[model samples]
Target: MEILSKEKNARNCKFKTRHGEIETPFFMPVATKASVKHLSSIELETIGTPAIISNSLVLYLRPGLEVIEKFKGLHNFMKFHNVIFTDSGGFQMLRPAFLIDYNEQGINFKSPFDGKKFNFTPEKSMEVQEKIGADVVMCLDNLPEYGQDYESVKDAVKLTHAWADRCIKAHKDKKQLLFGITQGSVFPALRKKSIEFFNKKEVDGLALGGLCIGESKKKMFDSIKLHAKYLRKDKVRYLMGVGSPPDIVNSVNEGIDIFDSVFPTQNARHGNLFTSKGKLHILRKEFFKDESPIDENCSCYVCKNYSRAYIQYQLKFKEGVGYKLATYHNIHYITNLMKEIRLNIKENNFKKFRKEFLSNWVTKE
Candidate 1:
């Protein structure tokens, strides 16, 4: 709700939500099904996570609104007392029809849990988010997969813009922030058009969607840069579904203020760890006798008290400790990285840090 500081490269801001104030240039951990996989809300906060994202689609289908309303909202149900964002169910509708169905009216999908069919329209998505009571809610926009033909991409973009308008009209509360998603795939011009369309409407924030679905890293970065140039700097700009360390740094340099992805938690569940040097495969046999922590510089509890050998052995034997430790370390690495970026911005050295970090980080790739 307040602009703390504006850097040459980025805007450092503070957002006032019902839960609390969240600093800008923040990374929101993905809690797709109202949970961040292996981590709890308290644990997430302990690891320095300022915010979390939940999917409206998953919650709408599974427990349904009736169940969530019982708890009053997602905040009480999940017990996460921080800023929360709920994504429109548009992305999930892109799955196979057996899993989800899409139509002109909206998306119809069967509950993965009970085979019960459910419909999610733009208005319906807004209603669900209102019931969920997230601080920020995304509009239900049609998101197409990568490599679609130009005509299909054009149609999807048009539909998304229309849906955004409908969402804006349907939304009842001005206090709860709503964001318009820009969906143009890899086409820069379409992206620009989408940006202009939303810019006129003047939503609370703007999100760059439909990237990193299956595109190359170059294409993804290109799209981000192109869209970033067109977005309003005063309001927040969120780059969705992108959370790699390199990607995070690059997007920050491009002036992205918010981002959410499941990379760290998902990879940690699979025995992978991200570090300053690069990614590490902790499940490898080379760590069987290794004594060093996952990252010597990491100050997370896992890195402070455990060794790579210990984690590898635990994971090898399917112990829960390995997964929990790895998750903590990875989340810490990302949150710390963001902290360093924010500090650099305050010091006006973000460009220098970005260059130095990318040199070593990219070399490992």
Candidate 2:
């Protein structure tokens, strides 16, 4: 893999994987449980999706690694023949229902499936992802949730580095690339320390985790930019769990190469729709009689055919098709947005485009 293009801090890069070569500045839809809720692999493919992320820990709890190994890997199991990334279940540490304890022995959590307690070690995480056969796997780091005390966050960052060491030693899959994550919450010093630590690790890429978890937008981007120059420029930088249109554009300018989040799909199900003009509240009576596409600028299946009145009517009536249409359109819109960003980066005019995008993309509270 080589850096394809550079537009100041923003980059356009590509790396080869077992499935295919994934271009940088890409967004991945969260396909936890091997599915993207109401959407399917076919719909995802039609959207020109370059990659998707799944929770390896969830699959391990449900179907077990035996089922995944039977089909050769996650690609065969999910039937999605593109780049697949498997998270190390570090994000699950934030959920009280699933979390049991966080110590040097990796994460201890209750099985949401069967209520069984499990001790998941960094070595176990590496093995699970290898068995799952994702093209890229993330290191198992201790993720601190929002509002945790400063000392708690600092301890989490230390544990993250320790786990990263073990994860590096445990990962032996030559065909799969490993990415390390840095977690420091809102502390710039801790963020820098975490970033510098991973900068020397054997991982193929770096990821900034634990952001956008209730922190102010200014703080989130500040933490990102503070460590932006500290990151190894040769490797990819993934900003986990940030998927808003404005955030994605801003993070790209801050030098992020990859991102994955459930926010967009979750928003789509709740009647928050992404349009060229702005986010649309589909259930509003204003669209009850209006006969317009969700976004006239969008040429997705939903926008090219379905009218706002029809979608609003279906959603108001709780139709299943409504959720699917909304999810598809959101994914399609983001997929195209990523393409536009990469194009501008290659042309060395991303900042100009970013300025326009940040001003035009209206987000209603």
Candidate 3:
């Protein structure tokens, strides 16, 4: 990972993994359970996704390591040539209404896939991530609920920092890079302390977790401002689970270099589509006879070949093609936006680009 230059907080950088080299300020599409929902690997590649992130815990529980090991790693297993990052699944440990439990030792939870029970410790997270063998891996960090009390949030940060240390010790793969995670809910002081703690570690990168979990936009952006600067400038900085256009702009301005989220694809599945002008719901009555493409500015296959009326019809009728097309266009939209962001940063016009983009991009209603 290397930063080539900076325009204020926005960066033009290069990230080289075992699989390939990519520029920073890139977006990673989420492929939870080892596949991007409804989109094939070739389709993902065609849309120009530079990298992707997957769930380490889910893969370990579902397919098991033996399956991935047979193909040599996640890249070969999934047939993707680009970089892949696998999250440690510490976040998943916090879910499950009553079956989840965690202490300093580790987390104990029942697999949602098979009703089987399993324990996930810091060492175990590393073991699973290493076997999955993605270009980048994340440390297992405790994530408190979004609206937790200050004391709970403080304790979660302490546990996360402690787990980061253990993860560093257990991570032995030379080919894969391990990233330390910082958790502090929305408390600025705790966020600062968490960032500083990770700065002292020797991990390959740093990730900001526990945001966008139900917090207001103001709080989430404020938290980013409070801690993003404290991160080590020499390594990559990732904001986990954030992918809205406005949020991505804010994070990049705060110096975050990489991102991953299910928002675009997830929303696409439900007929919510993103466009250069604003968000669009294809199933709306306004598009009943609209023959226009999903986005006139977009050149993706879906936009190039289909119209709003057709996609709306497919979605309204519960046809599989609607989901696939929306997924394709949405991914293309965000990835294209990232490409434009990188260019603007290089040209020293990122501030202007962000301002113009957001001024015209309507996200709500």
Instruction: Give lDDT per model, in order.
Output: 0.84, 0.89, 0.88
Better of 1 and 2 by TM-score: 2
Clashing pairs in 1: 1-14, 1-15
Model 2: per-residue Cα lDDT over 186-225, one tens digit each: 9888899999899898889999999988999999999989
Q: Order the candidate numbers by lDDT, best to worst.
A: 2, 3, 1
Q: Candidate 1 on 113-198: residue-level lDDT in tens?
A: 67778777889889889988888999999888788988899999998988888899999878899999998899888998998898
How does residue 354 of candidate 1 score in lDDT? 87
TM-score of 3: 0.97
lDDT of 3: 0.88
Off by over 4 Å in 3: none
Per-residue alpha-carbon lDDT of candidate 3 for residues 165-251, written as tens digits (9 for 90 to 100): 999999898778888888999899999999989889988888889999999989998988876667778888889999988889878
RMSD of each: 1.8, 1.3, 1.2
